[model samples]
Target: MQGPLLLPGLCFLLSLFGAVTQKTKTSCAKCPANASCVNNTHCTCDHGYTSGSGQKLFTFPLETCNDTTSSKTTQGRKELQKIVDKFESFLTNQTLRSTEERQEISSTVTTILRDVESKVLETALKAPEQKVLKIQNGSLAIETRVITDNCSEERKTFNLNVQMNSMDIGCNDIIQGDTQGPSAIAFISYSSLGNIINATFFEEMDKKDQVYLNSQVVSAAIGPKRNVSLSKSVTLTFQHVKKEDPVLTIITYVGLSVSLLCLLLAALTFLLCKAIQNTSTSLHLHLSLCLFLAHLLFLVGIDRTEPKMLCSIIAGALHYLYLAAFTWMLLEGLHLFLTARNLTVVNYSSINRLMKWIMFPVGYGVPAVTVAISAASRPHLYGTADRCWLHLDQGFIWSFLGPVCAIFSVNLVLFILVFWILKRKLSSLNSEVSTIQNTRMLAFKATAQLFILGCTWCLGLLQVGPAAQVMAYLFAIINSLQGFFIFLVYCLLSQQVQKQYRKWFREIVKSKSESETYTLSSKMGPDSKPSEGDVFPGQVKIKY
Candidate 1:
């Protein structure tokens, strides 16, 4: 019985092995070009290829995988245009001024744009079934996900993907749809689309070299129900929406914190120190106050997008405050130039009087009028979905940038005049203030004043092509710490203020010693003997 059972089992195993071998042999058969056999009997096109436009033949020999680049160029553009046209319809029919609606529009438009862009990238790069995108620590899978609108109960689904090599670094940094490339670049040309779409050309530290060869811009005029065409000018790039650099965030917050501390100290010093109270310190005080309020409001309320009126009010306040700060800065420069012209005059007494009369009205009034004009004209352009600042549409940003640039230009001229006058006239004035005569001190003060008077913002003007990132970091760092610079130059570095601080410190120490001595003496009874080194009645000789 055991032998019979073993024979049957061996027969069954042999039959199973024969079936497996047959399947393997069938799958190993030669397949059509750009196609492969799978599951022993079926043929499928290779990755990046699709089957020919015909019915499958019995022998599976007629089907072929064809390249999709030309077909994709024709069909993909049609689909993409439809998406853009949909957005254009929405823009035409609906008002998107509210912060929430604007954000929804931005996020939706970019999502559509990036999806089509990714398909274009796959065609360009000839990538396979996997997404061409190469995120640092994410999967290669692609699937649609829901985008739930926060402002309303609306929800839509979309996929975010890109096609690029993992080895290609900084090819996707996506700087404002700006790129220089041997590779074609794709971007959403309209500024209203927001920063959701981006592309990067240079890798880190490679920006300074090969600065000129950027790709062309393709303008798509997607009108309501309009047919759109794709041009060869534009290509697509990818950017992952990730949190900002932790290091930069830390640096910004830390710098702002230091600036706030310094501003407070400077304000207190200006208020209390009678010795340093002067026209310069007064200008510094107002500048410090404006900056303090601006930065504080920015840190706290810049992203408070809800309650739209509140956000607009905050934007208006920020605009006014920052403009006022720059206005005071202009006053500082004018006063400095006047001081240089009146070098022989002791204490800048007459200049000080002249400034006091005009500073308040000019410093506060100009910003008020500018804001009032802006409010009266385009009141709705105050806040954006992302930031509580002037809108960039319809040349509205110029309301701020225009005044700033003018002030910067005037300040530049003032700074140059002051420097020239100081160099030419310093040696001739014997009775000039000691602070203004020391060449090193004077040079340092002049440079510091230049920065404080908003010359550093000129760095923004140089933010083009290759030097954009460098100039951006410099501008952010220097301007963010403007309050600290004012305090350093006007309060901590001033000889008069330093002297006052030292005097105050000495007095504090002296009083502390006296208090300790009195406590010690009081602990002893009236009949108790004084220490051996005691001076006249209850006086202990204190050494400071």
Candidate 2:
């Protein structure tokens, strides 16, 4: 009985394998161009295409892919209707045989497909330059020359140019639980496979709600929360957007390079120069170190977004490091204010002790705790597919922005108070000439101090509306070269640092001259020793 059962099971397994193999072959054999078989039976469309019923682009008869603009409450219908008329006129003028189909895939979306025969079918002509439109999730997407159907064996296939207008993308489904508006993002199919990749922020129209993208951009998604699911169908719009600006790229890389060099030099100077060793220099050193690490990590690992977990870790690190740098800047401002307050005193020993007690714990510990809290709450939102930084969705970016704003506020207050104190002190001096000179010096230092302490980040907050470009450039140039300013003000211009450099330079030259003379005397000959005539009167030579 056992042997009989075993034989039957083996036969059943063999039959099942054969059936699976046959199904796989059938799916692949019938799969359409630009489509592939998955799981041995299902044929999936390539990245830029979608099925008629809003399913994954599948190889089904009568299935048509549609591109569309944004879906909504009939605001932009007039413009879209004009485009539709143009499409119909094109079809009529060409005498192209076509069929129209309307699909109600969901309660919110209606997909319309106007299938026009290829020109190659009518005459011995190349395929007409056509455009394709798809509507899903309340956006309009247009694609030109979507299909190339010609007579050659490699190219002979049905091609389509589709257009969609005024499709409804239910806004209720897109917003989900979030109160903020959704962002318009585009999705494209992977070149080598059937998966989708989001290519967001390609371009925006002059109108508030509409976006424009290219044919290469296939689907449009709402918001950074791409993972969110929606109950209704979406229509994506595609239009051409300019590539990344070369000028912006040039500014960023060049500024970062100069900042890195200056930071490294400043750090070295602080470490090696004992004369400048104090609470101020120590604070500057730590500030430079934090900024250096933050910048270096960003430049190297920002684009390493492949492994999701690693990208999240990088985002967390960046969050902590940048916060720490800003915290140190805050500490620097506090230290300066303290110094200014106590300038009338003979010594700063008390202030030094007080700073030592306060600076380190606040500078390093606060950012760590904040980051830890943020990570604990929503670690998954730490990074996006394209950026290894905090997600803008669900107010996660506030974790960074909040601390920066607080620090900036505190620093600004400290700056104002310091200025007031300086003004009062200058007024107290009896000599007019001395007071004028001191006032001038104080004014320059105050301006430089505000910039050095990361106050230029204010420009970032003010970047809005028409002047956004001007503010953006100013923000980038000022903040990116902060390390250079620190080096210039704290290291190069400091009297103590300059004196130390000059002292070291003279000693180095004197030592080099003595070594050269010694070398010349030795190279005269092995037996040649310094004589009384060659050497100073007190010099003596010993030979062994």
lDDT of every predicted structure (CA atoms): 0.63, 0.62
Q: Model 2 off-target regions past 4 Å?
A: 1-243, 430-443, 526-544
Task: Please provide, for model 2 over 4-88, each residue's C-alpha lDDT reduced to its tens digit, 9 standing for 90 to 100.
Answer: 9999999999999998777656655476655667776566765444555777845354455543222221323344454444433
* Model 2 lDDT, full chain set: 0.62
TM-score per model over all chains: 0.56, 0.55
**What lDDT tens digits, residue by residue, belong to model 1 across residues 1-544?**
8999999999999999998766655753666787777765667676556777543321345557786655664565555556556555544443442334435655765675565455444333333232222221011112211111221222211123322211121222211122222132222233223322221222223555633222222222111112233222232443222224566566667778888888888889989999977788798889889888888888888889666699899999999998998999899889878877776655666797899999999999999999999999988878865568886545788899999999988988988887887787655555455645554465577788877777677877786778877776777788778878888888787888899999999999999999877777786667887566555554556443
